[model samples]
Target: MPTLRDIMTPGLVTVDPQATLKEVATLMLEQDIGAVLVMDGEHPSGIITDRDIVVRAVAYGHDYGTAVTDYTTGSVFTMEADTDVQQAAREMADRQLRRLPVTEGGRVVGMVSLGDLAVRTGGSADETALQGVSQPSADPQ
Candidate 1:
């Protein structure tokens, strides 16, 4: 049962809520990440993803100058750094989230993405179960 701090990506990449979509997109590209946390000063406000840019901005024809928060998804979700990584993974799946802001003492400390969870729990029970079903069964006597 690893803690989020053990597998989380520290040094989160964030953008101000007032930042333009172009600016956020630029940051994502520069960082080579799919998601960016939107912050309102010291508090997390929302999140924007590369897919959101393509779907909301491109599909809706929102100007690049539009604020990133204008089309952010749902609300910001945070998990304590000391929490069990499996718990965070479960919450993310339940909420249909790909990532979460990692916190300690109510202050943003890092980020835990779906990729991180996959890496952490890659070849354990879940993978074994998946393999049991996906692989062909041998002939039974």
Candidate 2:
């Protein structure tokens, strides 16, 4: 029964919403992370993941110089630090999201990925949740 605080990648990586997709990609690479928060002051305005860049931006021939927020999941869904791993997994799957930002005291604290869930849940995780998230979508953005 690991909590999100136990397994999440502690520490937040953020970018201004105005930053270009290219810049966001560069940051993710430099940090060795798959997601970054688009911060609007102290709150998150959106979230962008490596998959989002590839599926939503690259696949669509979106200009690299366009603002990252344009491709971000603008209505961000986050989990509190103490949330159970299984609960987090279910929510992510239901949302068809691969990553989620972790929060504490209404502030970004860490990040969780499906990979984290797999490892923490002893690799079995949840097949239905995994398939739900991994399914292909024709979403334009």
* Candidate with best TM-score: 2
Residue-level lDDT tens digits of model 1 in 16-49: 8889999988999899998888888888898888
- For candidate 2, the TM-score is 0.85
In model 1, where do residues sit more than 4 Å from their true spots? Answer: 125-141
lDDT of 2 by residue, 54-128 (tens): 999999898999999888888899989999887887888878888888999999999888788777667655554
Relative to the true structure, candidate 1 has a C-alpha RMSD (angstroms) of 8.3
Candidate 2, residue 85: Cα displacement in angstroms equals: 1.1
C-alpha lDDT of candidate 1 relative to the true structure: 0.77
lDDT of each: 0.77, 0.85
